[model samples]
Target: MSNKIAILLATYNGEYHLREQLQSILYQTHSDWHLFIRDDGSTDGTLDIIKDYASRIANITIVDNAGEYTGSAAGNFFKLLHFSDYEGFDYISLSDQDDVWAPNKLQAALAYLSLDRAGGYSSNLISYDNAMMRTSYIDKSQAQKNFDYFFQGGSAGCTYVFTREACLLIQRKTVNITTYKGRSHDWLIYAICRANDIPWVLDRQAYIFYRQHANNVWGAKSAFSGLVSKFKILRSGWYRDNVIWVAENSGADVKGVEVFERVKRNKLVDKFYLLTIVSQLRRSKRECNLLVLILLFLF
Candidate 1:
């Protein structure tokens, strides 16, 4: 059988740039992929654009969505999965409405994930570097270096790819996460990888462009706004909250199964090894005393 890939395009009133994006995919070096287009209630002519292409593109599957925003990114993506039955796709990639995918995006991301998940046992994530199309940015060398640098802070999700195993784990393992509305999608996805001891690797920014616009719900923010935005960005350690929240919001019964399995199999020598945490925290205060003094002085 031919290798299959599915690009889940979750869109809302994106007629402005929809056709161009579809064409970019068609121009890909690898064309053995399906396009799952979800119109999250487009008032624009987005559905029309999809329809125009569907007649010519055999692999396009469209999901009709209403304009009432889902209140959260998790809700939006979960809604897409529910519509697609999470079936018939080998590699699942997250697609945005207004972005441009460089021809080698799929080839590059798959190469990294293929190596990182060599055993093909569990979930994995692959992300890329993106230029802000219609805006000023750097050159090729800068983009390449920035891919790893940007990915180390996790992902911004314009071109994040997931394996079927990743989807299944979300379906099977992370049923009862407690993620909040208007929270971070990329952060929670990364945290889930961490929680289940699943492996993840950066794909070194496979030539993607994140299109910025005025009506964007997510992506493209120009500095924090007011106290609230500042607080949200400044709350540096809130990643834990995102983890717990995703489980709770999932509304599934994952108890005594997945997370438990992850904890049980953790290596004894791991930094937060269960046997050592109690002792480490106790010793931390004493050992970190000098470090704390230096930190305080430097600040």
Candidate 2:
């Protein structure tokens, strides 16, 4: 039997591009899939559009939200995963309400996962700005460094596909969590798999058209703008907080850096000590240098 995939789609006020994204999913080459959608208190026509699709499609399911608003895309996705019968599915994929998936996206992901014997899969994306009519390839498939998952996600969550075993591990890790600590879901998932020694494949192929818009929670930015944004986030101490949270919660046997414990205390000496091992923290040299600067000044 062909692999049956459960696609978890999270939506907010995404009425504008929701139809196009839904249409793209309907045209996928891999047809053995079920779509489970959950809305995070959308006050717009997003719910109506989802209802229309569910009305016509037998395999599409609208997960009941119980009138509780998650208030964030990551939270809504976590709720979707918690409520969906994912254990019954052979594989699981995540979807955003505004991205257009390639026709062969699922088929290609499944092929890579099977061939590599991997537990999780993610790929690069083609980020498109509709208003500007500009497109750029976003490459997130850099070589994995020692603790890269602790710093960033492998790729966009919309491009993520996980084996049943991977899903089980995620569910177990997040079972007792009441709050997500403002961390991206994709980062947490990648961290979980990596911490458990699960082989995760990062495909160089682009499988989704990641939409960039004014309301995007984490949209693409220009190089300079991205640097400025990172600076602002670092200045606010959010990065340090998240790193400590992941270290504590990700189940990794936090080794090597004996100063990790002191760094968690926000000590100045330990922060300086971390600057020496920045290469192990991030994947790219540019990012590693930036991380060192952040530790030296911002931390």
Candidate 3:
């Protein structure tokens, strides 16, 4: 089997953090990898930094994201995602422009993907914490406290990796869609894994020291705001997609919209979630004000 990987990066004006992020990938425990980058019309020196890396690094390839064919940022992201189908790679990592990965990041995630399950390699998600981060738009308490438990969500875009099965599904679905001002990709993928019953892992260690700079699309919100935004993210593109709408999904496809209507008609998880929210709200009120605010902040 080919132990090859393509690190697909989606970039736009990421000059400042790009170098550090790239360096982290280079410092991986396993080096049999190719770095593929696409620039989304960056006026900043982001493209220059990529050029510098490509010049020095033999495996790296830089492509211009003309922002012409794809109508939006999500489309831009998908453009890079179609790497393996066109380029022929065994695995692809959805690399963010900002986070600093731990040296073992690739090793751990790729190792998991390479494992033999049953007969063939099944798609799995390995998400780790971006331990160190500073955010402007995201509510600090809500965003910061994510994943106290291991692999809480599917995986953050900052350090998400995909196996061939998942990549092929993504291509078939054409999932590079922007919703909620492009803050929707992470949740959408989570819903995808959930609906398809895809197995995933939430790695406890901090694989990437995620930096929460101002340019991040959206993150860090009070639990209420976070959930609301996520719901919107799910609902916007979610209203028309045909994917099954399980508890975790936003119901974007036709079936998804149907699921939402059915849920609304029958009152399913909505009441259950509302009840949980109410209980939590009561519990928070009994706790200290600061603590309650933090809990709410992370909601």
- Comparing 2 and 3 by TM-score, which wins? 2
- lDDT score, residue 114, model 1? 71
Q: How well is each residue in 1-299 modelled by candidate 2, as lDDT tens digits?
A: 35899999999999999999999999999999999999989989999999999999999999999998878888898898888557568999999999999999999999999999899999999999978788999888878887787677889999999988788878888888787636788988888898888999999999899999888888797678877987788889988777666656667536423644756766777776677677877877887887787777887
Clashing pairs in 2: none
lDDT of each: 0.53, 0.85, 0.54
Clashes of each: 16, 0, 19
Candidate order, lDDT descending: 2, 3, 1
- Whole-model alpha-carbon lDDT for candidate 2: 0.85
lDDT of 3: 0.54
Best by lDDT: 2
Q: Per-residue lDDT for 1-299 in model 1, tens only?
A: 24467777777778888887888888878777988876656678887889888888888877666555565555566566555445666777777777777887777777766766721111122222243333433122121121111112245565567777676765554344433365765555544453454556654344676666666665545544434553454365343333335444332114323332323343434213422332211122432353233223321
Which residue ranges in model 3 land beyond 4 Å of their true spot? 67-73, 83-88, 114-153, 175-183, 221-259, 262-299
Q: Candidate 2, 21: how far from true, in Å?
A: 0.8
All candidates' TM-scores?
Answer: 0.65, 0.94, 0.65
The list of candidate 2 runs beyond 4 A from truth reads 253-262
